[model samples]
Target: MQKLKWGMIGGGEGSQIGPAHRLGALADGHFELAAGALDHRPDAGREYAERLGVAPDRAYGDWTEMLEGEKGRSDRIDLVTIATPNSTHFEITKAFLEAGFNVLCEKPMTMTVEEGEEIVRVAEKTGKICAVNYCYSAYPMVRQARAMVQNGEIGKVRLVVTAFSHGHHGDATDADNPRVRWRYNPEMAGVSGQFADCGIHALHMASFICNDEVATLSADFASTIPSRELEDDAMVNFRMQGGTVGRLWTSSVAIGRQHGFDIQVFGETGGLRWASEQPNQLIYTPVGGRTQIIEKGEGGLHDDAQRLSRVSIAHPEGFPLAVANIYCDLADAIRGEIRDGLPNAADGVRSMSAVHTAVASAKDGGAWKDARPSIFK
Candidate 1:
C-alpha cells in the first residue's frame, strides 16, 4: 500500500506535541509530511514547515490558507493532524472535515461539549474519519488488559481505579513563564485544567479497558496555585453503565509523583493492574491464585496486544510508539481495512462530555452528574 500524504496544524518550533505527532505519524513510514500550518505567524510557519522537510509551496501561514491551497491541489493531503491548543481544535477540525479531509486531533477534541457534538455531526455528514489522540489506548498492555477483561479472564468487573499524577505544576508558575501559561489560562485550556489535560486520558483508559461507559459521576477540583485560573487537581467518582464502581484522580500539583499514571481493575474472580510508568508489564491475579505478570509481545498474550507490539517484549515502547500505533491504524482505516480500537469522533464526543460533566460536578459542590454517552449515538 502507498504511504498516505499528511499535513499538520499547529506544532510550530519549540512546541511539545507537534513534533511528537510528526515523529509518530511518520514512525512506521506509512505517512509523509506533505504540508502544514505550523504556526500562527507566517514566517514562523514557513520556517517550521521547512524544518520538517515540507515543501515551501505546501507550507502555509495559517490553517485557512492551508485549506484553501490544498482544496485545488491535484496531490492533496489524505489527512491532517491538529496538534493545536484546546480552544482552536473545533474550528480547525471542522474546517478540514468540511473540506473533505480526515482528521486526527488532540484530545478533549474541543473546548466545549457543543463544539465536540458539532464536529461529530460534520464528520458523520461528510463520511470522513475523525480520530482523537487518546494515545494510551494504543499501548500494547492496555490492549491486552482490555482483551483480558472482555474475554472474561477476570470475570465480571467490580471496581476500577485510575490516576495520572505529575509534579511539574507543583510550584506556582510566574506569569512570564511561557512554557505553561496557556495551560494555566482558561482562555487557552478550557474550563478544566489538569483534568482536561490528563484526566480525560484516565477516563478513556478505564472506558477502553472495561468496554463500559461512565454513567454518572461526581467530582472535586482544586488549584494548588492561587494565581492560576484553573484547577491543578481533580478527583472523580463514578459508576459505569454496567454497575462497576470507579474513581479517578488527576493532579499536576502532586509533590512526588511524576507521570504516575496507573489503573487497576478488580473483577468478581480476579483482578488486573497496569501502569504507564512500566508499559511493558501487566499483573493479573485469579481468585486464590498467585499473580502473573504478562509482558508485551510475549507468548500467551492476546492477538490484539501482539499486533500492537512493535518490538520484542524486552524492547520497551512508550508514548511515541503508542502514538505510532494510532497513526498506523488510521492509515489502515483510510485504506478501507477494519480498524478496531481506534478512538474516533464518537469517542471524542464521549470524552469531552466526561470533561464537561466533571467540571460541572465540581462546580456544583460535587453533585453527581450524568456523562451523557448517548450524545455519541
Candidate 2:
C-alpha cells in the first residue's frame, strides 16, 4: 500500500481548516504531510509550517513556491489539499491540478461558476482525482440512507424537505470575529456569502442521498442581519428530476442554532430522515409501520453502512471524522478504486448557480426561474 504524501496550501497557524486537514489525512494512516504554503504572510506561513511539524525549509511563503518544489519532488506530494478561503481556492487548486497533482478541496468549489466549471475541465484534462468536501456523504448512516433511497426503501420518492441553520456572525463581521472576517468579505469568500458557506453542504447532501438531479425551481433570499453585506437566510423550492418537490431552507441567523440539518424524504410507502446534529441515527418509517431508528454502529445495519462505521459505536464521530472520510474516499479515488462523487466539482458549480440565482432574485424582489440550475455550466 503506497501512502499518499499530502501537502496543504492553507490551514496554517490561524487557519480554521489546517488542524482539520491534518487530523483527517492521518485518520486512516494512508496519508502523511510533507509540505505546506500555510499563510499569505511570510512569517505567519513559516510559523504555521513549524506548528504542523513540517521541516522549516519545506515550508513556503506562498503556494507558487510550494507548487514549484512539489513539481520537482513529485514523490513527496502525491496530492495537495486546498483549505484556503473561497477566492484562493481557484488559484491554489488550479496550480496544483495543472501541475498534475490530485486535489481534495473544500466546498463551494470556486468563488464563481465560471471558475468552478473551468476547474472541472482542467481536472478532466489532467486526469487527476478531484473532490469537494461535502462531509455529510461521509456519514455511515447517510451513505446507508443513500443506498436505501436508491434501492427503494421508500416505494417512490415524492418530496424532500431540508433545513440548515446556525447562530453565527449575524451581527458581526470577520473584523469583529477574527475567525470569520474573511468569510464576510466578497473578495476573500466570493459573492454567494452564507449560501456558499453552508447552504451548499445541505443542497449537496440532498442530491447525494437521492442520487437525482434537481431540475428547476424558484427561490428567495436575504441579508436579514443589519450591516452585513451578504445574505443570512435563504429559501429554495426545487423540482427534482422525477418531479419530486423539495423545499430547502438555509440560514446563519436563526438564534441559538449550531450546525443544524434535518433532511426528510416522503414516498408512496415510506420515508427517510436524518439530522446532522445527531449524526449517529437515521429515521425510517414505513407508511403503515412503526418508525425505526438506524444507529450508526448498532444492529439492523447494511454491510456497506457497517463498513464505514469505522469508529466504535460508543465513540461518537462528528465533523472531524466526517471530514476525514472525504480524505479517505478521495484516497480510494487516487488508487483507482472509486470515482469522485461526494459534492465534487460538478456539485460545487450547481450550488454556485443556485446561490447566484437566489441573490439575483433577491435583488429583483424575488423573481424566480427554472432554467438556472445549480452548477457552473
Report the lDDT tens digits of candidate 1 across residue range 59-124. 899999999999999999999999887788999999999999999999878988888889989998
Candidate 1 worst ten-residue window by lDDT: 172-181
Candidate 1, position 259, lDDT: 84
Clashes of each: 0, 6
lDDT per residue, candidate 2, 1-377, as tens digits? 87888888877775677777788888888898888888888778977787778888788888888888778863768778888767688888887888899988887778777787888889888998778878788888888888888888797889889888887765554335756666656766667667778776777787788887666656677777556667778887787777788888888878688878889988889999999888888899999899988888887676657766787676788777887888778787777778334556677677777677667766777676552443322
- TM-score for all models, in order of appearance: 0.97, 0.93
Q: For every candidate structure, what is the RMSD over all alpha carbons to the true structure, in angstroms?
A: 1.4, 2.2
**Runs in model 2 with CA error above 4 Å?**
171-182, 339-341, 371-377
Candidate 1 is scored at a TM of: 0.97
Q: Which stretches of candidate 1 lie over 4 Å from their true place?
A: 173-176, 373-377
* Alpha-carbon local distance difference test for all models: 0.90, 0.78
Q: Residue 150 deviation, candidate 2, in Å?
A: 0.8
Q: 50, model 1: CA deviation in Å?
A: 2.0
